[model samples]
Target: MIPKESRNELALDTFIKAHPHLLEEMKELSAEDRQQQILWAFEDEAESRGLEAWELALELIAR
Candidate 1:
């Protein structure tokens, strides 16, 4: 799980705030683009946590 402090550094809440626009665009994206965006966000969060990529992938997938 991501710590609260890490969440701030990753600007996760900020990203989520901009999600409406992203979501709208996402609807028009191919499946691969959607997956890429999710992976990018996951990687950003994982970097903030000093976690491995696989860990982040698992966490994100679980959600």
Candidate 2:
């Protein structure tokens, strides 16, 4: 089962549709590799966008 924190209040299908190539790449990775990639992506995204903006985005999407 996916963790709620990982869900980030966004639909899985929506994320997949928005990032099909990244999703496909993730499927090709080992479990550990994919997890690290995801974590790094989250880190990079948050750093680029700012943590406050990231929180706001999550709130907006949840609504």
Candidate 3:
């Protein structure tokens, strides 16, 4: 089984790959800041859909 941290990273990677426009919008930030922005955006999106962030991450990676 994958470690939980690894799973989360995979989920985030999957999320980023599926949304290239997000990367385009954050091109000016440092890499760390860009990742933080993406994480917050992902969480916000999940909240808007009434699901926990992990659930959205899972759904993204599953696709």
Backbone collision tally, model 3: 0
RMSD of each: 8.7, 4.7, 1.2
| Model 2 residue 11 CA deviation in Å | 8.4
Candidate 3 achieves a global lDDT of 0.88
Better of 2 and 3 by lDDT: 3
Highest TM-score model number: 3
Residue pairs clashing in model 2 are none
Taking the tens digit of each residue's C-alpha lDDT, what string does model 2 give over 1-63?
546656553533343355577667799889788767765665565567666535634643575
TM-score between candidate 2 and the true structure:
0.50
Instruction: Kindly give the stretch of ten consecutive residues in candidate 1 with the minimal lDDT sum.
Output: 7-16
**TM-scores of all models?**
0.44, 0.50, 0.85
Clashes of 2: 0
Which residue runs of candidate 1 sit more than 4 Å off their true CA positions?
1-25, 57-63
* CA shift of 27, model 3, Å: 0.6
Candidate 2 residue 7 Cα shift, in angstroms, is 5.8
Error of 1 at 48 (Å): 1.0
The alpha-carbon lDDT assigned to residue 44 of candidate 2 equals 60
